[model samples]
Target chain A: MRAVVWIAEGSWQACVDQARAILPPDTAVTLLHVAPGDVEALAEGARRGLFGRHPPPPPPHGSIREISDAEAGRLLATARERLGRECETMARRGRVEREVIAACAQADADVLVLARDGERKLGPPSLGHHPRFVVDHAPCTVVLAWAQAPPAVETIPPPPRHRP
Target chain B: MSEVVALLALALALAASVARVRFAPDWAVAVAGALVLLAVGAIGLTGVGHALTRFGPTVGFLAALLVLGDGCRRAGLFDALASVMASFSHGSARRLLAIVFAVAAATTAVLSLDATVVLLTPIVFATASRLQLGSRAPMYACTHLANTASLLLPVSNLTNLLAFQAARLPFARFAALMALPWLTGLAIEWLVLRLAFRAELDVAAPQDAQADADAERRPLPRFALALLALTLAGFVASSTLGVAPVWVAVIAAAAITIGVRPRPAELVAAAQPAFLAFVLALAVIVAAAGAHGLSSAVDALLPHGDGLLALLAVAGVAAALANLANNLPATLIILPLVSASGPGPVLAMLVGVNIGPNLTYVGSLATLLWRRIVHAHDETVDIAEFTRLGALTVLPALVACTAAVWLATQVT
Candidate 1:
């Protein structure tokens, strides 16, 4: 079965690497990372309580590639290091959802494995917008790779009762 | 004592209906019932003149655009566009999405908001399927962005109409300023959605050059175009010529019914559940206006001037409230209050609240229309989702816009 994996910010490709290690040797895998519009968003994501920053790659082959900053190139290379002989990388230009869906159509891939951390629940997945949109919209069967067990819920103090 | 009892009953009824919606999980039925009650309230109890005045322009514009939009839809304009989009399939999803957002924004800047929803939903649906993609992703982006784009131009949306009429703004000035914020908001909204869907976008196939015959072409009759033009004329006449909007819309709808020979069922299908919400908003806001008197009273208090903070606060409050309430009636309820303030405040409030609807599905007619259409994809957009995602997307943009306008007041 041909499988296409979506690459996201944070540890998406890392999780894909983990999945690649686990998949049958014969199953062909394609890794997809749709770049953010401006590299600055990814670069500045850390302070906003999010992680994973990579500069955009030079435009993909046969596609437009505007020059991005040095940081974007470094991050793209760092993320691209994971693809093995069994997998190929397609660094997409533009928004995430459209890229993934378009790639799925082009590849005619039989299965779509969406690799992400913290979404590996057995029940309905709490996918972020892109994944959720993919789950909601993508045509081929999708297998999402989230965390095996959800992070343990932490208890918080209850609020004080208002004195009316 | 009587006032307290009435208030209690009102609160209880609202509470019960909300609880029922949660319990039954029957959103459509719940909304339908609410719309019925609201419509009855508007037609029977609320003065016809007040309801008509608030929605008159919107109804007129929608009616006109409906004819034009329907004609375009029949003419296969969207389908042809989809064919063009499909031709670019060899490109990355990112490029495709950029095209969609850009087109959606531009089309909505000229076409009405609801028209954008009605027209784009099917094309995106068809395009996604044609592309071997099926997700609520396209639906959400198209719907949300369509509404966002509609607020950019005066000719594009009802909210802009309110601002245009109130500010006495020439179309050129309206476009010059709001256009920047409009693009900014769309880019921000798209970026947020793109971030949400980053992984799903990676795909590779050489998009084919063969145009799907159905996607590229549709047979639209000349009579249909004429009818559409006539309806459009009626809509324009209502707004620009000082005729009643409802009468104009009703006449156009009647003429279409008489002329097109489209299925009566199709007309009802075309006239959607969202219309009920829109009409309900008209009723509820009119009633709410009588009860609260907060915004109007506040506008009465403030002297419209170069007071930057005051203008920003008012604009911010109007935006929040516009999302809190729907934008149409929100615009209506606030119009008088804004007028009382001044031209500068009027323009600011219009831009802020009109665009503000994109923050939540309940915020505008187009978003609400999207809620209905997105359902067909089997993924739903809820109020809570909007509140959460909107914080990252809608709220920040709203802040940026208000700040932009407040700054503009100094120079303009």
Candidate 2:
């Protein structure tokens, strides 16, 4: 009977704020984040600089340091501030969508709820196309809940799957 | 004199084909080689007596085919048919069956069966590759169906027209014979192919997971819509007016060539090798009649109430020979022969040949085109593999049709 809420990648505060708004009182929420690392996708790339084009423009530099008790505690703080003391939060880290799917299966969760800045919505990396895949392979139904309010319209009023 | 020359030339052409099979090249392949030389000799020895135009039925047949096939292609009329087929197939065998059925059925209805196969072959190959649906089912099915379906309509097949003319049967009666073969052959084909490739059913779907478009050409299959319409209209008119099938060809070709910047050899191309073969057969048969005892003998044999079985046997043998040794010529050769066999049996035989070649790769011109299309896409399919799948379907269908024809003979 577990319902898992995933805090997808974005402004930690904005996503936390939305997650808090959706969860019921006393619900346990898992705070997830993609740990920063040089995930050289191609082991070959790491072993031998796999590209001739000079190293990709350096990833932006700034204060990405831990903000609270747990490294992801900063996101949880934001969620708690928005939702109040009713929900218990714990931080977990991995690839956003992949981790969410695996975690949902492990938690025996009924649904995987993720918050999207109406714009960060190309969809959870591989998990979005995975519904049909899951339908094909998963033993249970997957409920994909996304924040529909389109990002550009400021008012945060009506909802939609995509802008158009 | 012209008759003598024509007969002589035909004999030489036959000899030349034989030499090619034995030694080939110089004697067999040259333009002045045995075949054409004989044809030329036939023309020169006597010449067209009082003839203003040398190509009568030939030219007319060509023109009509081009006009009709071109016009429909222009309209995007058959463009949608491909997608419709892709949707119908449920799995490997069914999908392949659908592809073959679509090509065969379409060939029977609109374009000449060979042209129909040519037109649809590429589409079939593309669909197979795009879907990554393996098993030689589609290729064999397309070829078999093309050959089989060609017998359904008069305008769709030269053999049908000759039989129709020879028999002097009404439209309704001719149509009645058509129904049984087309449906039965298709069913038998499906069943055969299913059994042939039953082992391949669990074959995998493409992992790429994308909609694929193989070899679709535009401005070609597109702009020919007008020609297609004219061609069909010609067929409909032929039935109504009782004009020779050649008249339909003349009108169709003229409609295409009139003051337009026609694509170079485009009409000829679309009228197709298969269609041209039929035309050539017609010319050859006409030439052979006087010398070959084709007329009186054929007359004596046909229009018989008691000789139905003999007549059917002749027509059936002629069609099978046509399928084996070039269907077009076989058709032409047999047309006069069957005039004696009577039209009912003759028409039934044409129907049989139309569908019979589904048994082998080289059985029909349409099949060769379908094979070419599949290969052109870098897709590999061997004849043995094709025949294997076909045997599963074609033999049964042929047997069932044989019974149907026998029963039909009794009914009449």
Candidate 3:
């Protein structure tokens, strides 16, 4: 079986750990990391807001894109180390959800693994908007893992009282 | 009647574009509004020329300052400064917060708020993260001070540039007049930020051997520092020399760019023709609007004198307008009416527009940009939390700064 595991910031460890524990030992896994383009967009927005169409000189340290790419690589490397297996690693950029979906399709995987990245309480929001979209729209079987220990059932708020 | 309707429609469209349009640049939206006005004959070519002539120096100075700021960033000025700030922090979140306040305030005062927002914010965020300090206190300090600390100099904000031109105050005199209000605003901002982010500020800094080594190796950008000092001196001397400060800014910007040896693209971006064009177009649109009934409406609502109550009222109105419209357009709309009243009301209005944007996301373009930079660094600013902080800080800063301006006017 082919599996694609989505590795996102903060939640990659959970997804990778779950993949290791659950997936068959022989499953072909591709660890996918998407560097959200919003960072570059934000940097560009600042440039445009101040200078208009003109692009500022590259920063002495590194450009935002470079830093973001390096960060994505570092995250994927760390995840790979924790997974303790030989697997293909992929780094893509753009919208996080869309990129994850595309990586899954391109990998031709039978199952997709990801972690809930938002609210920990029991509800629709437990899967953040991005992960929720990926889970709802992915073209393969979806395995959902929690980024952290699940919250108590009582954490959910009570329903509103009805008016007579 | 048709002309007034067209102008009103144009105003609404411009506001929406500024607030919501993400596909196109702000300068493009503003240019589109200017074209519509011209197409409708709300303003003649001669009137356009006049507006350009009036605002040309402000736009020129803004572009030059942006270029200079960009050069300094390229030379690692802000990075070095952040390193120094981190070193001074000595592994204490509280000390880091204090250092952030001082650095942000001084940066806004000297280099302009755009520099603080666009440049200093990211460095501060990185520094905080590297030191394992809570990023909230230092990050908020950068953004908040970008607005409040801007009161110290004429070149501190684009709005200040407009107000300075209309008020016709000498550079030194302008700084002197705003000095008290500027300091008062920073003090209030510091107090409120400390209270608001007490949990974040109370953390103990972790010992990071790698970060300490990195901070030690970051070299200070002495050339950029000396150039900035020289530029500031030129701004003060220009008033006595009977030359516009824009000349000083241009020379300084050119010097820095040449020293940094930017590529062609960098040079063009530094010139920022699109933003300069936006400013010129905005000038025409504002002038046209002022001519066709908008000014009369604003005039009727304006307080009559420069008394304490009157100055406060004027500032309150300007703040409301700034939040309603963005601060740049708000400055254009309020400036002519306030300028007629004298430097006192103009300066008071400055206090409102500068400080007021802290209240809402829509209050200033700089605040909006600041939000983007924070998000870019993977940090989230909850809207409720932001508004809560803004509500706690803006009014106190506004009232105190406005009163300071009033007192300064009385004394000076």
Candidate 4:
């Protein structure tokens, strides 16, 4: 079975652990991390806004793009090490939700695994915007893992009472 | 009647495009609005030509400063300075905040607020993140100081440039008058931010071996630093030399371009034709509006005299207008009304527009740009939190700054 595990910065471990626990040992796993393109946009925006139409000289350490790529590589590397298995690691950039969905489709995976990346509450917001979109649109069976233990039932607010 | 309605519609459209709409760039929207006004005969072709003529020096000055700032950024001057500031903090988050305040203020005063926002903010973010200091306080420092610190020099902000041109104050005289208000506003901003972000600043800055090593390794760009210093000196000397400040800036920009030897395309990008075009178009629209009953409407509301109360009234109205529209347009509309009231009210309005943007995201272009930079770094400063901080700072700063300017006027 082919499975794609969506890895993100804070909750990648949960997704990796859940994928490892449920997927068959022989399953073809691909680890996917989507780095948001805001950093590159920031660099470009600064260039066009501050510098005239020309590219500024190279920064002393590295360009923001280079630095951001290095960071994504580091995050993916850590996620891979925790998964503790041979898998294809892919890093894509742009909108997080679209990239995750596209990765799953391109891999032709039978299942998609991802963890909740937003408020660990007991409602719709728990999935956050990106995960919510991915859940609704993914083409395959989806496994939603919690980054941490789910909140207790008491944490949910009581229903609104209408006056008689 | 139709002309007035058309002009009002164009104003609302420009505001929405700048503050909310994202499809087309602000310059495009502004140019479109200018064209609509022309087509409606609200303004003639000569009016457009007049705006280009009147604003040519201001636009050229802005473009020149952008190039100069970019050259410094390319040469690693800001990054090197940020690294040094980080090192001087010696692993104390509080000290780092102080250093950021000082450096950001100096950078804003010399290079302009846009420089502080675009170049210094990212470096400050990276530095804070590296030192494990938590980027919130220092990043806020960079953005806040970008606005407040801009009050010191005519070149520090586009608003200041507009006011300086209208008032015809000598460069040194302008600096002398603004120095107290600038210092007062910055002090208030520093204190309020320190209190508001105390949680972020109270933490110990853990020493990161790699960060320390990185900071030590980056070499300072002395040539760029010298160029910047010389440019500031040139600004001060321009008035005495019987030259407009724009010439000094243009010459300095040319010198830096030669020194950097960037590609031609890079030079064009640095000039930012779209932004210059936006300024010119906006000027035309404002000029047309002023001609068609807007000025009399504004003049009726504007307070007269240089008394403290009058100055405060002018500043309060200006701050409100800036928040309602954007500061650039606010400056364009307000300056023509207040220039006749003398330097005191003119500088008071400058203080308001400069410091007032701290109150909201749409109040100034720099604040909006700062928000994007913060978001790009994976940090969020929501509207509520931003307003809370701005409320805590802008009022106190505005009052004290206006009072300072009033006092300067009285003493002189």
Interface RMSD of each: 18.5, 25.3, 7.1, 7.8
Candidate 3, position B398, lDDT: 82
TM-score of each: 0.55, 0.53, 0.73, 0.72
Error of 3 at B114 (Å): 1.1
Candidate 3 lDDT score relative to the true structure: 0.78
Best lDDT goes to which candidate?
Answer: 3
DockQ of each: 0.03, 0.01, 0.08, 0.05
lDDT by residue for model 2 over B1-412, one digit each (tens)?
5455554554444333322234432122322322443464543334322121333444355446545655454445455555555544533435556565665576655676644544454455444434445313565555556666665566566556555655766544565666676667667766766665444443434223123322232233433555656655656566678776567667655654553444756655544443344244335434444344645543454444325455455545654654444454455555655555455556656755565555555554343454356446532223444456546655566556655655665576
What's the ranking of the predictions by TM-score, best on top? Answer: 3, 4, 1, 2
Of the two candidates 2 and 4, the one with more favorable lDDT, higher being better, is 4
Deviation in Å, model 2, residue A65 alpha carbon: 58
Residue pair clashes in candidate 4: A51-B270, A52-B269, A52-B270, A52-B271, A53-B268, A53-B269, A53-B270, A54-B266, A54-B269
TM-score of chain B of 4: 0.92
Identify the CAPRI category of the predicted complex in candidate 2. Answer: incorrect
lDDT of 1 by residue, A21-44 (tens): 666778777776665432212111
Positional deviation of B330 in candidate 4, in angstroms?
0.5
Candidate 3 backbone collisions, by pair: A54-B269
Ranking by lDDT: 3, 4, 1, 2
Worst 10 residues of 3 chain B by lDDT: B377-386
Clash count for each candidate, listed in order shown = 19, 34, 1, 9
TM-score of model 1 (CA atoms): 0.55
